[model samples]
Target: MTYSGDVTPGGAPAVRELSGLTVSKLSVGPMDNNAYLLTCRSTGDQVLIDAANEAPRLLELIGGDGLDAVITTHRHMDHWVALEEVVAKTGARALVHADDAEGLPIPAETLTEGDTVPVGDCALEVIHLRGHTPGSIALLYRDPAGTPHLFTGDSLFPGGVGNTDKDPERFAALIDDVERKLFGRLPDDTWFYPGHGKDSTLGAERPALPQWRARGW
Candidate 1:
């Protein structure tokens, strides 16, 4: 039942406990995209975020039991490159924002802001973040102990917000959502898992909010 500290040979990172849920992260593809697997221990229901790359490794993680669904954070090619293969192998439902749904190789059910994605007994509240992609969304889960776990797909990261163009409007919108919907509302202790790289806490990234805004991405 214990997970390794580093990514296992199968490419799955150490399993971490977030409240009642078990989270397994994987780094795949040439882009090093991050894929997350959330399994509800109580119900054995599991969902995956970003079927990026390495179908064989991902399929190994899903195991014979398969997955309940796969949620695509955005329509970027790097994030969903393995979508077709994973879905074909597991028969897991695919979910993406309506705006970005067309970008996928196959049609995916749309999930918008305010919607709740059920993973067994746990629920992930969706938050639509703009700029990086119009349909880019983040998932928020508040543990019983009151800690917030955020899955911000390419929208927010450790150093700063997701890459935005010189377009002031786009940068402004992205920072606005990150500051208000995310930093403004969540506690400093909130844990944010992004589409790539190591996980970060709101507390770790809070003080730099002004800098991120002033510099403009």
Candidate 2:
């Protein structure tokens, strides 16, 4: 039950602390999906992204701390496998974009582009980026020191954008949204936390934009 340990089994090995925000990442489920817990240190208010799987393990991570909300980045099953149980146990509200609400097992509050999700004193600004899913969204938080932290569901990754339909139009739309909504607006030092893998910064992925566009994937 200690805070911030990097090398323990079933524990979040990768932890990042900034301002009053603390992010702990755990790889869960058969797909090895990444679930994140964002906590506001000042008020102890917390939010979780992608419950994915292993409810017991997730409950362990929660460690009796009350959760404010459990947000589903998209409608994909892999991202929500443990959502129902977690929500039931924690009494946390489920939040998802309106476009993908019907896909969830239980009811969810509507979330749209430009909305703000309150986490204690912190406000997580929403950015609805389409193509990976009609409702795919990312959350942005600017810490006290002016550093930006982004939670980019499955629409973006370290190397390129998320998996998309084979249709050329679908691929084009995703790339365009990512370029305009993410790369074009965010700063180079912005740290992004994705749904299923390693974290990456805007600076690391900026240079590959053109290459990704050319590949059309």
Candidate 3:
């Protein structure tokens, strides 16, 4: 089936396709945060990104498919409330950043910048993007056809950016990182899947960087 739209309750965005890897978006929590499901076509292996608050719904989505791992973008409760339950239901290993790995309900395999995580025949590179949280990360992956994909949690958004009000220095750093690391290097065609709002391309967001910067983060 072709993947599109929010598949979970509360208008969460999700996209799945049998052709390549499938990506499902789940809306969780009072804030309506987005969680993702990435499935490998070659091996039917899957990885869950940010469990949110809908454990039962996430489990149903994983039905029959072998869940290999769960990745948390950061330590925020809105992003990880259901992480333990999903791990228990799918028997999948958890992957998180070392900075925020502690205090999680489940054991997790810590990931750092420059690390590559494999699922089936595909691999996702971990990019440390602090600001929204000390351990926030963006997962970058390339499809078989060389299409670049970036799963940016609260770190980035279309037209807008992640909330960094928790710390001024951290927020400033995050803005700088987004400008240099993400917007500067990545191709315009790169697909940006954010933690909230609709999806957009790097090309689309490039023009808006100045505005975001002008706002002073």
The backbone clash count of each candidate, in order, is: 0, 0, 4
Question: How does each model score on TM-score?
Answer: 0.94, 0.94, 0.91
Residues 1-217, candidate 1, lDDT per residue (tens digit)? 6543244334547688866898888888687788889999788899999998888888888888669899999999999989999999899999998879999999899999899999999989999999999899999988886688999999999999998777899899999998999998899988888898778899999999999999988
Find the 10 residues in a row with the least total lDDT in model 2: 2-11
Q: Residues 1-217, candidate 3: write the lDDT tens digits.
A: 4444434346535665634677777776666778888888878889988887778777877778768999998888788888988888888899999988985777899999989888787788999887888888999887757568899999998776799885668778888888887888789988878876567889988988888777867
Q: In model 3, how large is the Cα lDDT of residue 21?
A: 78
Off by over 4 Å in 1: 1-12
Looking at model 3, report the run of 10 residues with the lowest lDDT sum. 1-10
What is the model-wide C-alpha lDDT for candidate 2? 0.86
lDDT of 1: 0.88
lDDT of 3 at 41: 81
Task: Report every candidate's CA lDDT.
Answer: 0.88, 0.86, 0.81
The numbered model that scores best in lDDT is 1
lDDT of 2 at 53: 86
Candidates ranked by lDDT: 1, 2, 3
